[model samples]
Target: RSPSYLAAQGCWPGRRLQGSPALSPFLSKCGTFPPESCFFSLICSLGSFMVMLVGLLRYAHVIECCGPSLLNTLGLAAGWICAAGLTMVGNFQVDYAKVLHYIGAGVAFPTSMLFVFLQSVLTYRMAKTRGHYWTGHLRSILSALAFITLVFSGVFFVQESFVLQHVAALCEWIFIINVLVFYGTFTFEFGAISTDTFLVLLKASQAPKSYKSDSSTASTPHGHSHSEGLAMV
Candidate 1:
């Protein structure tokens, strides 16, 4: 399943329902809803961390393929921060530690956005260098959309009106969707990596010399060859 699907699973039927308040219903209160919201929180943490880790691992290929660049490094750093932030968010429940929750969220959200932007830039650069369209142009379009939605989300969040706040919430979800879709663009690259890795592992596991012959003769305590039949005489 897509990482986004995994993430949505963490929060579905719990909060942020259709035609609801601007803020996540859980965020509106001190504790989680249905008293089991922490479970979802944990899910979010795990899913988010997994997604970010995959993205980070993808960076090794990026670095190898694209060579070292400041943008790539920045994107990797941002991804690490995003993953750590997600872990923190999961570990610290909002109701239990509001300060810590906000801190974690603060780290996660902006860095997540930053990761998106840096990755988009890097992808665009790589596409241009390789003369590829999908990674460069298509990904650029998705990144642009994500950036726009994120801007709307941030803008609406600062507004005083409930309707605007709700709109902001909706935009936030849209931004997330864009980010998820953007990540999906890497499917081809990931598949290629998996295939190559599998082939390399298969080759490494197969031994050319299946069997070996003893190069030296074995001798018995009587100074006779063990492999030779003993003389009847």
Candidate 2:
């Protein structure tokens, strides 16, 4: 509807209709108008917040289960950066803020690809159960598809042909969908998370160094016994 509304006002490229062959509209372009732009901005902002929260939870989850690793840290950074880019994309309309919008797009797309790839690698590394293995395999496929689509979208976007541009737009949509689905996959692991997981992290962070060392010395034998019981469970 926004596309058609833009078309009616000659806001679209070549003043073409929504499905016309002249120029396939970018998602940003569809939200360039008044009412739709407001909704677009709101949705993007909310999405960015959700992405950031999810990234933090994932980082904390990894720290809790597998201990800290460089890959997990890097993935969190990439996810947060991508979220920042999304905020910029939503607030800056391409028509009015072309440079800022493109900059945001530039930041968002590559970082999102990196984030998914890193998470996929981490998933494989952390795989213990059959379900974890299957999750890794699914993430790997989605990461590959996302990277391919992102590359094609970028390459075709600069082409002179409208048909190519339409293809590029299609690829862009696919890339976004793939990324969203990748985020959705986190539910598999998140399901097993409990409040104790975060509480342990908080306590570990707040505990004094002297107390930690003393506790480690005192509990070494008991810790081993507890770990074995946990593993068996």
Best candidate, TM-score: 2
lDDT tens digits, residue span 1-233, model 2: 45667667685655455564343467887778789899999999999999899898888888888887899989999999999999999999988999999999999999999999999999998999998999999999999999999999999999988778878888999999999999999999888789977886676567677687888899898989999999999
- The residue-level lDDT of candidate 2 at 1 comes to 49
How many steric clashes does model 1 contain? 0
- Each prediction's total of clashing residue pairs, residues at least 3 apart in sequence or on different chains, is 0, 0
Highest lDDT, which number? Answer: 2
Cα RMSD to native, each candidate? Answer: 12.5, 9.9
Q: Determine the C-alpha RMSD for candidate 2 after optimal superposition of all C-alphas.
A: 9.9
Name the lDDT value of residue 228 in candidate 1. 46
Please provide, for model 1 over 124-217, each residue's C-alpha lDDT reduced to its tens digit, 9 standing for 90 to 100: 6666445455677777787778778778877888897767877777777777677778777777567657555544434433533332222222
Q: lDDT scores for all predictions? A: 0.66, 0.88
TM-score of decoy 1: 0.64
Report model 2's TM-score to 2 decimal places.
0.80
Q: What's the TM-score of each model vs. the native?
A: 0.64, 0.80
